[model samples]
Structure formats: structure tokens, C-alpha cells
Target: MRYAVSNQPEGATFQVWRGVLAGASASLVGIGLARFAYTPLLPAIIGAHWFPASTAAYLGAANLGGYLVGALSAGALVRHARPATVLRAMMLLATIAFIACAFPVSFAWFFVWRLASGISGGALMVLAAPTILAHVAPSRRGFAGGAIFTGIGLGIAASGTIVPLLLREGLRQTWLGLAAVSLLLTVIAWNGWPAQDAPSSPVNEQPKAKSPPAPALRALFAEYGLNAVGLVPHMIFLVDYVARGLGKGVDAGAQYWVLYGLGAIAGPLLSGHLADRAGFGRALRVALVLQLVAVVLPVIASGAALLMVSSVVVGAFTPGIVPLVLGRVNELLAHHPAAQKRAWRTATTSFAVMQAASAYGLSFLFSHSGGDYRLLFAIGAAALGVAFVVDVVAVARSK
Candidate 1:
């Protein structure tokens, strides 16, 4: 009879922490610095005469568009290349983009770099969690996932907090500083990845194919799309909305973003814990409710304390929902791992595409609405409301 024990090497536990940190660093550099940094930096960019404020929507959309392209590319790249190699290369590219943006170039030129940044961000978002999880024993997978997901919040918080302080030096210096930080994070994470890996694994595409029903699948796709729609206001304009929309200065706005980031740090761990006890579907519903509240709160209340709560909830659940949906997908496809892989790719792509596409639409709406972010927030809240209903239906059907 064989007795069960962890098959990990003696130092595996130690390396797991390193891998976790590495994964978080990936998030920090990609989502934290490369992608979401635009939020706090948007006002600074405008103030520095780098670009017209009118182009904010296009700029945000460009990043999301590049993110979509990156997501599609990852699906192909995984088939032919090593994930570790790909992950590191993307980090390096993101670092370069960050540094390059320090130069005040044409709007078109800066747009290209932002696009590249988004692509790298998208790739890392898809890749990092799996890479980190590979280092942990199966029993601790949730912990690994939580550890990895926290990187988004960490990055968000860093941007919210650090970018404001650095702006005192000037926006150009801020970009240079972010680029250096990105380089450091990339190096640390690169070294933390397993020195060896199988030629292919879950992070890479393997042919496992199953199709859920068309209507149910469509509903899931819709929820994925709306998730981004509900999120764009906070992601792209939270700082500006607070500063310009609420009559707060940029500093106050950045402070709110920091609080938001702090809340984000709690989201994934609590979400995972909740999933462990209540089931992924139930936990997801809880997240959706909180997210809905987060979106609607700002529209209904303007007080300092209330808006702070709104910021926290938005920040927390913004990155929180992704893992929960991925968890649900895994559950939905428990019987067919191959199909699950395909489903995940589909869900992820749909989500990215919606996010990319929605940027243009929603931004146009905001600009057209005479810059009344309340209208924007209202629309965003409505999107979340639809997501809530769609999610409830999808969860029931999945059951």
C-alpha cells in the first residue's frame, strides 16, 4: 500500500513563495504599472500638455484593444512556444513601453506604446496565475491563486499611491520611475519561475474540446462582456471623476484610488475563501452584488466617507470577479477538462474583446454627455445590473 505524501522537493515550499511573489510581480508590472497606470496618469498627461483631454477615451480604448490582440495572440503562442519565455518577454516589452512613454511624443506615437503595454498586460493576466500555481502542491492551489490575484490590487494601489507622489517630480520622471520599478519586478519574477517546465501544460493550449449549449454559452459570454462595461468608468476615469466630477483635486482622487487598491487586496483572498465555503456560484453572486453597489454608490452619494466606501468596493471587486468566473468555468467543465480549456479561452477572449470595444462606446457617451460622469456612472451601474441578472440565470442553468 502506498501512503500519500506531498511529492514536492524538499525546498519546494520555499520556491512556492518565490513563485507566488514572482506571479504577483508579473501582475504588478503588467496590470499594475503597464495597464492600469493610465487612470491616475491620465490627468497628469493632460496637465503636462502631453495630449488633449479629449483623447482620453481613445487612449484607454487603445490599451484595451491591444489587450484583445494580446489575448488572441496568447492562444496561438501557447501552441508553439514556452510560457516562461513568453511571460518574461512580455514583461520586458512592457518595461520598455513604460520607459518610452516618458518622452512627450505625438498622440499617435504614445498610443502605439500604450497599445503595446496593453498587449503585454493581457498576456500576463492570462499567464501568471497558472505559472505560479504550477509551483504549489494541489492542496494549496487556492492559496496560490489568491496570492497571485492580489498582484492586481497591489499594482493598482501602487499606481494610486506612488504616481501621485512622483508627479511632484513631474510626469516624465514618474514614467521613468515606473519603468525602473517594472524592470526590477520583471527580473525578480523571471528568476522565480521554475527553472524547468514540461514542454507543454495547462498554460499552453492542449486540445480538450467540448461545447456547452449555445444559449447558455451566449449568456455567459454576455456576462463576461458586461463585466468590462460595468468596470470601464472606474478603471479609466476614477481619478478624474473624483477630481473633476466631484470637485476634488487630483490628490484627493489619487487617495481614493489608493483606498480602492487596498480593498482590491482583500477581494481575491476573501472571494476564494467565500468560494471554498459557499460554492463558486454563490460566492460569485456575492461579488456581483458588492460590485453593483460599488458602481451605484457614487451616483447616489457624494460625501467623502461614502465615496471612499464606493472606491474600496470597486477596487476590491474589479479584479476579484475574474478568478471567480474562471472557477465557475472549471466547475462547469469538471467532467471535460479539454473542453474547459477551450471554454476558458473563449470566456477570456470574449471578456477582453468586450472591454476593448466598450471603451470606445462608453467613452463616446461620456464625452457626448458633456462630461457628466454621473451619467457615465449611471450607465455603468446599469451594466452591472444586467450582469447581475445574467449571472444569476447562468448560475442557475449551470446548476
Candidate 2:
């Protein structure tokens, strides 16, 4: 593969593009297979009587808890480990977790695997972006970033299709089958990434003269944390709520989940494009409004048509929020790379903790209420509304 050299900015070629593809593949391996595969599997595991709804919720929370741990440790891990090593190891564990779920193991054992999977996924996320930056050309970074993130969408789309088909064989077969596919993907993404984490570019290495305002920290941290709470409904219950709760078959739920994936695939590209014209703050506010409306619609409306629309809108916001929020963060930290990296790590930590806590809290609520999916959606909507308010206030304060 052709490597970009110090004097040859113009030499960025197909080799650079291949490295970007590797980063994207890592994304698919990490988020797509690890995080999203569970959503589709939630209903199947329940149907097989592997766990009750409430217990299933705890398992999901355990995965996010692992993510929180991973996110918190990401910086230190990068310092001590190679990006490729971390990526490969995490992908292997995630693949193992997928297959482990296929066994009729004890709940404690299953939980351990899920948590391991979450840790792997979270670290992969923290590692993948920087790996790309180290390899891709400057002019191509934006496209590269989009490609990597879009892996989540692609993985979701694949799970939506592959899981449903495999379930026809049996839930255990589905798990094993998915594990096989994940193993293949891990190998491919491993090949695509650079052998080292040595960044050719100094994207975040510049020293800043001054730190950002405290208000900047408060605004971003709050926004990031609350954003995860707003997403708990769909993340934990969207498929099950439709299939088991609403009396729709598993296939219908999978179909809607696919729609959600399709929305996710499109959301980042479209939102990023709009953010350019309208500005990140303005674009994000619009998305929050859309997301809030979408969250509330399933409770208000009764038709399949409206449900599909809500799924797409909700799905769009889930992955879509990353670019929008990161854009706003960049705006705040433009002059201070050191401050920017520091604040982003803080924000990421906040995000992981909030998401993990909400997963546990909501799962317990669902159990106590005997699986009241509507209540969960309402709570999610309320959280999104609060996030919208925080964002609006932040924009106002910036002015």
C-alpha cells in the first residue's frame, strides 16, 4: 500500500482510501456487531425463555456498564497498547460473546460475556477514529470519518436482515451464525487498519494557550449525558416492544428495525451536509425536535405507517447525534486542541455513565411495571425534551 510521506501531500491515493475502509470495517466490527446485534437478539432470547424481560434488561445494562468501564479506560489503554492490538482483541471477545449467547449458559456467565462484549465495543470506538486520522489524507478526513461511523448503520442493517433469517433456523443457530460472520468481519477489519497507531497528522497534539470556559464544559457534558437517556427506549426495547408487546411477529419487528438502520445510514451523511449550511447548533436543534416528536408519536398514533416514520426518525437521531454534538464541541474548542481533547474525554465519560445508569434504571422499571413499553417511551421522550432545552440554552449562552 502506498503511504503518504512528509513532502508528498499530493501522494494521497487509493492506499489512503483503503486505510479509511479499514477504519470503517473496525466500526462495523465494534458497534454494528457488538452493540446492535443485541437489539435484534433481545426478543429472540426472551422467546426462547432464556430470561424474563426484566432479567433481559439487566443483561443489556451489564453490556453498557462494560462500555462505561471501557470508555473510562480508553485514554490509558491507548497510551499502553497498540490500536491494532486493541481492535483485534476486542473484536475477538465480541465474537466469543455472540457465540456464548447461543449456549444455555447460566445468567451470570452470559452477563460476563455481554459485559466483555461491551468493553470491547467501547474501546474499539475510542480507538477506531484516531487510527483513521493517522492514516487517511487531510482532504479526505471528513469522508473517512463519515465512512467509519456509517459502520454502525451498516451493521444494524446487516443484523436486521441476517438475524431474522437465521432465527428461522433457531435462536441458537442465529447466535452461532452471527458469531461466525463477526469472526470474518473482525479478521477483515484487522487487515484494513494500520499496523501501528503512530499518527502521521497532529490532529489533537497542538498545545493551547488557554482552556475553554467552564460554561462550555457544563453545556457539552450535560447535553451528552442526557442524550443517552433519551435513547434508552429504542435501544433496549424497540424490537421487543413491537414483537412481544404489540403482538407483531418477530419478522415485523425486524422489518421496522431495518428501517431504523436505514435511517441511521442516511442520518449522518444528511445531517452533516445540513450542518454545513445551517451550522451545527442550528442543525442539532432541528434534529432534537425531530427526535422528540418521533419519540412521542408511537404513543399518540396507532397506525403502521406512522410507526415506520417514528422508527426512522428515532434511529436517525441515535447515530446522528454524534456528528452534530462533535461539531458543536469543535466549535467550542477550535483554538485549543489540548482543551478540546480533554473536554471530549470528559464528555465521553459522562455519556457512557449516563447510558449505563439509564439502562439499569429503565430495565428495572420495565420489570416492575410488567413490561409497560408505553411508559418507557414516555420517559424517553421527556428526557429528549430536557436535552433539547439544554441545547437551546447552550446556543443562547454562546451568543
Model 1 regions more than 4 Å off: 1-14, 55-57, 105-108, 134-139, 195-218
| TM-score for candidate 1 | 0.85
Instruction: Report RMSD for candidate 2.
Output: 3.8
Model 2 ranges off by over 4 Å? 1-16, 46-57, 99-105, 133-143, 170-172, 194-210, 240-251, 339-342, 366-373
The model with the greatest TM-score is: 1
What TM-score would each prediction reach against the true structure? 0.85, 0.83
Q: Write the per-residue lDDT of candidate 2 for residues 188-301, one digit (tens) a residue.
A: 776666665433235455554356667866877887788888887887688788889889987788788889999888776677666766777787788888888988887787
lDDT of 1 by residue, 1-399 (tens): 111124435544336677778888887787877777777788788887788888854776687778777777876776777777888999999999988899967888888999999999888877666655544543455556666788888778877778878889999999999999999988888767665442233533446544545566667668777887888888767878888987889778878878888988887777777776777767777877788888888788888888888888888877777677766765565445445545666777888987766666777888788998878778888888898899788657766
Lowest-sum lDDT 10-residue window in model 1: 1-10
Candidate 2: clashing pairs of residues: none
Q: Score each candidate by Cα lDDT.
A: 0.76, 0.75
